[model samples]
Target: MNINGDYHVHTAFCPHGSNDKIEAYIEQAITKGLTELSFTEHAPLPKSFSDPTPDKDSAMKWADLDQYIQTIEKVKKDYQSQLKINLGFELDYIEGYESAITSFLNDYGSVIDDSILSVHMLKTNMDDYVCVDFSVEEFARIIQLFGSVEAVYDRYYQTLEKAIVADLGPYKPNRIGHLTLIHKYQRKYAVDQGYQFTIERLLDIMKKNKLELDVNTAGLYKEECLELYPPQAIVDLASQKGIPLKPGSDSHTAKTIARGFNKLSLLTNN
Candidate 1:
């Protein structure tokens, strides 16, 4: 694989990630022969966004946004000659909060060079937002409430559709992160059928909006999901539909930089 960049990565600013310095990831990317790296720390949510059990340690606080941008901007200049660094955020798309999210992007989007829009949380039957990627136990519990894995998949894709069409002004993300992130626990709760219609609709939206797909490899490392996100079949379909694809390690730790890139190469080769 002739990988040139990694567009999804986190720093110590993300509480869920390791407390490694931003420089540590840059050093690792350089060692791995990557010329570009984007620090897409998870964007912070507003207080009004309901979280029954808030994972305060997951994302950076809204107050830290300034420091986070300053840190990346300074390092970007410092590494200009050695590597290309981009300032971006991994924006989470939650229903009923589009206005707040859009306002945030409108305020900072001009300064951002890249971004990965993702769906990490979904409204449950209980009408509260819960993380879909937190843990297998949580996933299992949520699926039971929905009655089946297929119901969960349906809702996930529907939410993704809304995310793709969302107008975050001109700075809306150009890339969709982990198209099948709902399958993070595939080994435990496999759906009987692939949501082909939903996937096709999403592809059409991306094609029309000129958005790209994050060929995320983090799932391969997860014991529950032994394949790359969105599955190989979806990748093939996206390739056929002319949807652009970018490799994202989704690295939360330094050691995970560019992990499972060989699998990404295989997708392109075919």
Candidate 2:
């Protein structure tokens, strides 16, 4: 509960994120008294997987991978005296691309200090996928693709379960990012209470795998989702299950670093 670390963060390298300099994020974290921060920028999607987002900005460009790594390495050295900067990625768990993900992790995992495996893309059909949190319009379209809001929720949670148990090699991230991200538009689409059973099952599997939960605060700030990802009930369940709860603002801009930290029960209780 003595929250001093933010394990989920994005950087300027993210095409969908701000153009803020990397140093700006570190400065903000230091100003906020955070001792540890991970620049878990979105990693590049697999070569064979076509990005479903309209702008195709879901992840960093494959061309920028090397430069991103080198820049973070230098930044790590520069800030080592003041902060613990982690080099990491917010990796997507595409159902069919496990091998490519494994290959990627095998190549770069050793250098990372922290990372998160998240589900942003959900397959809707044989060769088609949808970025579930892209926008209200996109969410509407996906609901149509899957035939209902409930079906979308079902598929999203199913994918999350698959990501948890799948063997993406030994370097697979131990933290599951934003477990209830499918609820991003809950105010608009309204989720049924039935999903609670599925969530409890997820926590069971997470405990089995010794996985951590990213108690993401970004959802609290989103107008459509005025609660933490998984909300308080699930957070309590995760805590009772002895799964580590790591607070993350999931900030995309430097100014938003530690954005909703104070509201976190983990922080408030302590």
Candidate 3:
């Protein structure tokens, strides 16, 4: 696969990611023969939302927002001749925080070159939530709260569907990230339900909305999920519908850029 760009990448700004410099990531992309890369660092959560994970490092600090952009701007100027660098954020789509998200986009969206809307935190109750892929213990707790592996999967798809159709102003990200992130630990808590109908519904809505699919490769490295997000079968279905499938490494470290490019059969076929 002649991969040209990686649309979803984290940076030193991410609290949960490595402290590798932004320049290092750009150098890695250039070394891997990628012409373009987007630093989709996790945006700060809404003020009303509380961090549920143990360490509470799922996203970046609000105080660092400006510096994050400025740092990127500096690196972008330096690497302009060598690579096409994009400034972006991986915004979370918490179900009840639409207004906050909209306000945020309105304030900063003008400068963003590319971005992604993703669902990392799942609401289990009116106020309580859980970070879906935080840890295996957390996944177990999520199953206990939702009552089963099936219910958790159902809620994830349902939330993703809502995210696809929700109105978050003009700055809303065009890419729907990691469509099957809930399967990150499927080997341990595998469910019997196929969720074919729900998956198809999501694809249909994505097609209608003209949203891009982030065919994330991070799941392939997860010990439990030895396949692509949405897997190949679902990838084929998206291809049949003519949805744009862009590969993303979801790399937390600079060395991980284009980590699984060869596994992208859709890119190869094209």
Candidate 4:
């Protein structure tokens, strides 16, 4: 598995991730023989929106964006000779806040070397955003609100389709993060339909837009998912379609720098 770079990684700035410093992650990446590492901490959210998680601290403070950028820039310089460090943010795609997100990206996107555009939250009938991967209880709540698991899947994929077409100026992310993140708890609450149509639509959109797919391995380590995100079949299809696939650890801690990368290599090889 000659995985050279990891594009999706979080740091202490991300409240949901470990408190480890960027240096710790850089060291770990060096140990794993990764040539490039990108610090893609979760992008700050708007004040009007609130996450429905129990902790309510999934993202960094909006004011801290400058500090986050400065820190990563310094680290990138410090390790310029040893490893390649790219600066970016894992921006979430919320339905109604496209303009706000685009504005933010326009301001900071120029400095970003790489980024992952992800759909982590969906709007409920109540007009509030709720996390799709927070917990099984939350997922069930969403399913109940939508009247069924398939309906939730429909909404999720629909939001992703919008994300694919969103305009974030010239700095729009070139990669889609964790294409099947909504399936984090598939083992607990299975959907009857295969979602092949949705997958095909997403792939087609990516192909047309020249967007890449994040072949994230984080799902394989999750207790419920127990499979690589997008699964093997999707990867094979993307390969056939010539949609570029970029492997990401989606690391929340220094210890998880390259988790499941070997499995990804094996899967892609076969």
TM-score of each: 0.94, 0.97, 0.97, 0.95
Q: Output the lDDT of residue 58, model 4.
A: 73
Q: What is the C-alpha RMSD of each candidate to the true structure, in Å?
A: 2.0, 1.7, 1.5, 2.0
- Per-model CA lDDT versus the true structure: 0.86, 0.91, 0.90, 0.87
Question: Could you tell me how far off, in angstroms, the CA of residue 250 lies in candidate 2 after the best superposition?
Answer: 0.7
Tens digit of lDDT per residue, candidate 2, span 1-270? 547988789988999999999999999999999999999989899999999999999999999999999999999999999999999999999988999999999999988788899999997766678899999889998998899999999999999999999999889999999999999999999966568889999999999998989999899988998999979899988888888888888999999999888877753321
Model 2: which ten-residue window has the lowest total lDDT? Answer: 261-270
lDDT of 4 by residue, 68-98 (tens): 9999999999999999999999988888988
What does candidate 4 score in Cα RMSD to the true structure?
Answer: 2.0
- Between candidates 2 and 4, the TM-score winner: 2
TM-score of 1: 0.94
- Residue 36's lDDT in candidate 4: 94
In model 4, where do residues sit more than 4 Å from their true spots?
Answer: 266-270
Q: What lDDT score goes with residue 36 in model 2?
A: 94
- The segments of candidate 2 whose C-alpha lies over 4 angstroms from its true place after superposition are 267-270
Q: List the residue pairs that clash in candidate 2.
A: none
Candidate 3 residue spans exceeding 4 A from truth: 266-270
**What RMSD does model 2 have?**
1.7
lDDT of 1 by residue, 21-107 (tens): 899999999999999998999988865775434455656788899999999999999999999999999998988889988888989
